[model samples]
Target chain A: MKFLSNLINGISLGSVYAIIALGYTMVYGIARMLNFAHGDVIMVGAYICFFAIYSFNLNPVIGILMAVVVCTVLGVVIEKLAYKPLRQATSLAVLITAIGVSYFLQNMAQLLWSANPKVFPTIINGSIKLFGGELSISRTTIVIVLVCALIVVGLSIFVNHTKMGKAMRACSEDKEAAQLMGINVNKTISMTFAIGSALAAIAGVLMCCAYPNLQPTTGSMPGIKAFTAAVFGGIGSIPGAFIGGILLGVLEILGSAYISTELKDAIVFLALIIVLLVKPTGILGKKIHEKV
Target chain B: MAAMLEVNDINVYYGSIHAIKGVSFEVNEGEIISLIGANGAGKTTTLHTISGLLKSTTGSMSFMGTDLMKTPADKIVSLGLAHVPEGRRIFQGMDVEENLDMGAFTQPKSSIKGNKEIVFEHFPRLKERRHQIAGTLSGGEQQMLAMGRAMMSNPKLLMLDEPSMGLAPILVDEIFEIIKALNKAGTTILLVEQNAQMALSIASRGYVLETGRVVLEDEAKNLLNNDSIRKAYLGG
Candidate 1:
């Protein structure tokens, strides 16, 4: 029973990681730049939701939607303002710029909302009882899992079918070739950041619901972990992010439950090392398939 | 035949290195113009400059009277210019059909299907491998895919850069035939190749680029039979 409960909680947590990891991977795929500020986007998302619901007294759903919109705009703006000019700059320059953006967001949040952790309300509080409540699943957990599934599904369809999505993939594959094909690389990049940040917002709100704390640094840990998930799954592949997140989540939870709790974080990193040692290209990373 | 593309003393640089110096050429409507040169002769650079991939330092490139310097690289395709760049720059990861779809990316969705079928007709091998990744296709097939991809846009001016870089002799002949056929079907062509003999055979007008300048420009037959041209380029 304890194992099963841990498994459920692990999935709940993994889904959140998957949502966040999707943003990291997608932004990396299109922009060819690692957006270290993605985690801070989650912080911005959480604060927006908190302010909308608590300060403005808006409906929780609308608050979440507004958070998505604001994060989307923030993401596009950040890309244009901070990243666009450095499109041709060296990777080191871009990396430092991303870190600078992350710090700027963190410090700005601290100034606006204060460093003290805000107590986020339990928007959805209920549980599904199983085995006479001995085994229980929270409604929030179920919602997070379902919503993450929807996002993954919806994103897959969009990337595989839509025109803009095709352009994104093409641009990611070959920017010069895509441009010659008449794809507006700038617009495609903006759309990619917008989508990634919107997913970040979803993960952020769901995370706040799970933890019920809205601090300026609330998004840092999850952001780092989700980035791990992306690297573990093969950074550019979408399904890799999903599977890597869930696997990492389960490993962390199971390690905590079965092994020492003090070493749970270490276990996750240890598992990532083992996976890399064996495959090096995450689970489904783009591999050199032919004898070219 | 009206001049579809006109270049006037354009200079292009790779960083501080002046790659193309005082190069001038013109392509007429429905004519095949070939730029033949040795390695490092600015053949690819010239094609790239006209495609807006590289900007000229101090000269003019006009396609159908629109200044190419002002247009963004992505918008060059919409201006009735299709450039099949060196090494067959097809999206290697995308499938054959998806690549053709990308070729017609500027065209409306309703027209993509029809454009794709036309491309397949031009290269039956592409039809067979519509679902196969482009990287997996043979060198000859990839070259065909590149040409067919350029055809998807149905541009007024089709520019090919080293379309026969690494293909069998028979495949080279096959590719030139298609290039000739496309020209006969009313598409103007600007071909750049190191294969001077075959390139000059089919070209209506020929320009020999050496050290970033047009060393000679004349009707293809005249250049083909010229004593110095035959000595240097045709292996004497």
Candidate 2:
């Protein structure tokens, strides 16, 4: 019974990671550039949502929408101003630039919002119980799961069926050929970043609601966990990221309950290492054959 | 017919190495023009320069009397110039239909459906495997997809580089047949090929490039029968 309860908790936590993981997967799929500042962007989103609720006294729904919009614009701006100028530079340089941006955003948040953890008002205060084991699920957790599922479905449809999605797919496969086909590579890349960041922002809001605690550095652990999920499923595959996130969440919860809480992150990392060692391409990733 | 594309003394460099030194040529409208050369003979470089993938260091390229040297690669497609790069750079992860749709990215959304119908009409095989991932396809199928993708843009001039690099003899014949059929349908083509015999046989006019220079240019039939071209490139 206790195991079942922990399992539910794990899934709820994993759902949050899955939402954040989608952003990492989407951006990495198209641009092949690891935006190190992605985690910080999550923090930025949380802070924006916080201010909207506390400072502006806006409704939770409006606050969430505003957070998504602001984060998306910030993402676009980051790509245009920071990444675009260094398009021709080495990958290492771009990676370093990403790190610089990450630190810059983190410090900026600290300066603006302070380092103290601010209490987030509960958007979903109710909880439902199930089974003899007393399975309790929060409204915030339900909303988070539903929103993540919606995003995943929406993204899959966009990539599989729509015109812009097809263009993005083409760009991910062969950027130069897509350009020859007259797809604006820059615009597509920018749009990818914007969408990915917006998703991250939503994940941040749901996380704040569930935990009800906000800090300048709250995004770091979740971002790393999402990245782990992205790698576990297949960095380039959207579906893979979804599965990976949930799996990670479950594993962490189970480990904390049965094993020790101190070993939770360590155990997860160990599993990741073992999985990677066995299958370098990941569980769902396809191996790319380079032509001579 | 007026020259659809004029390459006037274009010099292309890779870092400091002069890959194409003042190479000049003219592609007339509605004609199949073949640029035949050995490895590293600036055939691909010339195509890249004209397609605006690589800017010329010291020359001018005009397309339909418009200065095309300064135009970006993506914009060149809308200007009625479609480039099929070497190695058939198809979007491997996408399906056949998706790859074809990408070719029509510059056009209005309304025309895309119509263009897709035309592409399917030309290559019925692509229509069959419209939902199949391009990377999973055979080399010949991939080649067909590449050509089909280029045609989807409805360009006035189509540039193809080394379309027969790796394929079975039958697939090679099929590709050449498609090229001739495309030409007969009134689409001007710039063909860069190492298979000189087949290229010269189908081309209206041919140019032999050697070490970044146009060593010879003549009617395809004339070049086919020429002693030097026959001995060196045609394997006579």
Candidate 3:
């Protein structure tokens, strides 16, 4: 029963990681650059939620909406201003630019909101009784898991069934060929950034409900962990990110419960090292050898 | 007749190295024009330049009365221009059907059903492997898939670069046959090939490019019968 409770908690935590990981994976798959700013995008999202809810006195749903809108626009602007010009530059140049953007976003958030942590209101209040309230689950955990699942399903359908989605896949496969096929590669890339950032918004709001705390750096730890999840699942593979996030979440929770509370983060990183050393491509990732 | 595609005094350079120097040519409507040259002789570069893949420094390229110089590469496809690039750059990760879907990306949903049927008729092998991953197909099948994909757009002008590269002799013959058939069906063709003999056989007219310059241009039979062309390109 305790094991089941830990499993559910792990799943909920992992769902948050998976939400963040999707942003990293989709952008990386299409643009072929690790978007280091993705983690900070989550911070921006959380700040937006705080502004809309606490300052403006809007409803929780409305706050989430604003967060999504702001993060999506922010993502598109960043892509156009920073990443677009560097498309033809070397990977190292692009990597450094991404790191620069990440740092820039972090600093901007820190400057805007200051370094102190703020208390976040619970969006989804109350816990449900399971096994006569002995192993009850929090509303936040259920909401996170269900929301992540919905987004994941929606993403797969969008990618595999829609025209724009097919264009995205084609762009990832061969950008040059996609261009010849009349796909507006720029539009496709922008859309990818938009969707990834939109998901980050929801993940950010859900994160506030779970942790009930908002800080400029709160997103950094989860963002990095989710990136590790993406790599663990196979960087560009969608299901891989989902599965990797869940596994990482469960293991971290279970490890903390059974082993050492303080060593939970260390255990997660250790697992990442082990998985990478063994599989290299993550669990579901396909080997992407550079085409000659 | 007015030219459907015109390239005037085009000079393309690759980072200080002049690749296509003052190259000029024209393709009239409903004509098969072949540009035959050896490797690195600027044949592919010319095709890339014309299709907006590579921008020329000082030249004017107009297609269907549209100034190609200002248009981006992705936008060029919707202007009834398609390039079946060298190396058959098919989306290897996608299935055959998905590849065809991408080819018809710019078209309205209502047209794809018909266009796909036409492509399947042109290359039944692609239809046979419609659900199979494109990379798993044989080299010959991949070539056919590439051509089929190009055809999906129903372009007024179709450009092919080395369609016969690394294919079996029989497959090469089959590819040329398809090229001729497509030309007969009213699509203007600009073919770049090292297989000069095969390219010249079906083309209405031909240009022999030597080091980024058009040294020879004549009707198909005249160029085919020329002793200089025969010695240099046909390997007589």
Candidate 4:
């Protein structure tokens, strides 16, 4: 029964990681860039949600929506301001810029929201009982799962069917050729960041609901975990990121149960290292052949 | 016949390397213009400059009366110029259908279906492997896919940068045949090739570029008979 409860908890938590991982995967796929500031964007989203719920006394759903919109706008602005100029620059320069942006956002968050953790008002305070061993599923878990599933389905359809999605895939595969095809690479890259950040924001709100705590640095662990998931499942593959997140979540929970809670993070890192060592291209990632 | 595309004294550079220096050429409407040269003779650079991939530092380039120098690479396609870049830059991760769809990025939503059918008709192999990931395709198949993808844009001018690069001899002949057919279909072509023999044979007009300068420009047969061109590039 305890194991079942842990399993459920792990799944719910893993769903949150998956939500954040989507942002990482989408942005990485499109730009071939690792936006290190993505984690800070998640933190920003949580704080935005926190303010909306606490200060304005808005409904949780409305707050989440507003947070997503705000985060998306911020994402676009960041791309224009920090990334656009560096588009033609070297990979190292772009990477350094990303790290700088991450640090700046973290510090800005600290300045605005303060360093200490603030308790978020839980919309789903109570727990529900399930069959057999009476699994305790919170409203927060349900919301997280529903949101994650909806985003995944929505993203899948968007990438596979829509014109914009096709453009994005083209840009991801070959930016220069995509441009020659008349797909605006800049606009597509901006859209990628916007979607990625918006998803991160939603994950933030969901994380707040589940844990009911907000901090300036709240996005760090989740961000690293999500990044790990992205790499584990193949950084550029969306579906791969989803599966990686869920697997990571399950592993963490199982580790905590059988092993020590202190070693859970270490175990996840160990798994990441082992997987990368075994399959450098990842399980779902395709091997790329560069023409000589 | 009025020139459809004109390059007037254009100068292009790659860092410190002065690639295309004062290079000039003109392609009349419905003509196949081949720019043949050695490896570092700015053949690819000229094609790239005209396609808006690399902006020339000096001189002017125009396509169908529109100024191409000021235009962005993405907008160049909408202006009816399709560039099949060097090394067949196909979307490796995308399937054939998706890659073809990308070519129609600037086209109206209504015309995509029609254009796609036309592309598939030209390259039946692409249609057969429509769902297969592009990276998995063989070298010749990838080249075919690249050409098919460019065709989906329905361009007035098709700029091919070494389409025959890394292909079997039989495949090369087949590719040249397709290029000829496409030219006959009224698409103005700017072909950059290291295979001077095949290029001069198919091209109505030819330009020989030597170290970023236009050393020779004449009718295809004239260049085939040129002493310097035959000795150096055409292999006698």
Which residue runs of candidate 1 sit more than 4 Å off their true CA positions?
Answer: A288-292
CA shift of A183, model 1, Å:
0.5
Give the TM-score of chain A in candidate 3. 0.97
What lDDT tens digits, residue by residue, belong to model 4 across residues B1-236?
55889999999888998888999999988989999999999998888888788989889888888999999888998888899988999988788888888888888879889988888777888889999989889988899889988988898889999989999999999999999999998898999999999999999999999999998899999999989889999777
- Deviation from native of the Cα of residue A209 in model 3, angstroms: 1.1
Model 3 misplacement above 4 A: A288-292
lDDT of 3 by residue, A118-199 (tens): 9997778799998887899988899899999999999999999998889999999889899999888899999999999999
Against the true structure, what is each candidate's TM-score?
0.98, 0.96, 0.97, 0.97
Compared with the true structure, the alpha-carbon lDDT of candidate 4 equals 0.89
- Model 3 vs truth, CA RMSD: 1.4
Report the lDDT tens digits of candidate 2 across residue range A152-269.
Answer: 8999999888888888888888888888998889989999999999998988898888787888888888888889989999998999989999999999989988899999999898
CAPRI-style docking class of model 3 based on DockQ? medium
Candidates ranked, most accurate by DockQ first: 4, 2, 3, 1
DockQ of each: 0.63, 0.73, 0.66, 0.77
Evaluate residue A145 in candidate 2 and report its C-alpha lDDT on the 0 to 100 scale. Answer: 78
Docking quality class, candidate 2: medium
